[model samples]
Target: MTHEEKRAWIRLIVAVIAYTAYVVVILRRAEGGPLPDVPYAAALLWTIGGAIAAAILAEIGMAIVNPRASRVIDVRDKEIGRFGDYTGQAFVAIGAVAAMLMAVAEWDRFWIANVIYLFFVLSAILGDVTKIILYRRSVPTW
Candidate 1:
């Protein structure tokens, strides 16, 4: 696999792990209380911070292990990157719309924050997945 492809895989894995960690922590604290009462802001912040750190560490480790293998960035890579970015941006819009609807409905801040966070994670996952698939298969001409 190419270096970029490996990076995509790393992102996918990190996104999943980070999201799962956030959910697990929230659920553990949730107990039997109402959903809005669950402590989520700290968990959300931690997961975001941790995910960023993990991603950077993973990239550094990958670079250190095989310095020569990770240097290439070519035409195909750029194209795939753009495609993946465009694909992922859709989710951000969706998330914004969801948050707007929640606000209109007078939903709790917890729900609104969680929904936004979830959409960001989904965007990362979807973008990474798109890049991975594009790397594996030929990008179709449109």
Candidate 2:
């Protein structure tokens, strides 16, 4: 796989793992009782931070493991990136719209914030998945 492909795999794996961990923690915290208010801000922040740190660490580890892998960014890479970005951007817009509606509806801040965070994570995962798929297949012509 290319360096970019590896990065996509790393992002997809890391995002899923980190998000799963966050969800598990929240679920565990709510066990044996009513779904208590989730401490969403700190949890979301930490999960985002941890996902970033983990991705960086994974990339570093991959570099060390394959010291001779060419980390080159070529035309195909750029094309795949652009395609993925465009594919994933819709989720961000949806998230923003959802948050705005929630605000107008006077939903709790926690719900609004978590919805935004969920959409962002969805965006990243979907983007990376798109990149991976494009890498596997030929880029479609317009």
**Alpha-carbon TM-score of each model against the true structure:** 0.96, 0.95
For 1-74, candidate 2 gives per-residue lDDT tens digits of 99999999999999899989988877888676544375666777899899999999999999999999998899
User: Model 1: per-residue lDDT, tens digit, 1-142?
Assistant: 8988888998999999999999888888989778789878888998999999999899899999998885679999999999998999999999999999999999999999999999999999999999999999988689
Q: What's the lDDT for candidate 1?
A: 0.92
User: What is the Å distance of residue 47 in model 2 from its true position?
Assistant: 0.7
Residue-pair clashes per candidate = 0, 0
| Displacement of the residue 93 alpha carbon in candidate 1, Å | 0.4
Model 2 worst lDDT window (10 residues): 32-41
Give me the displacement of residue 100 in model 2, in angstroms: 0.6
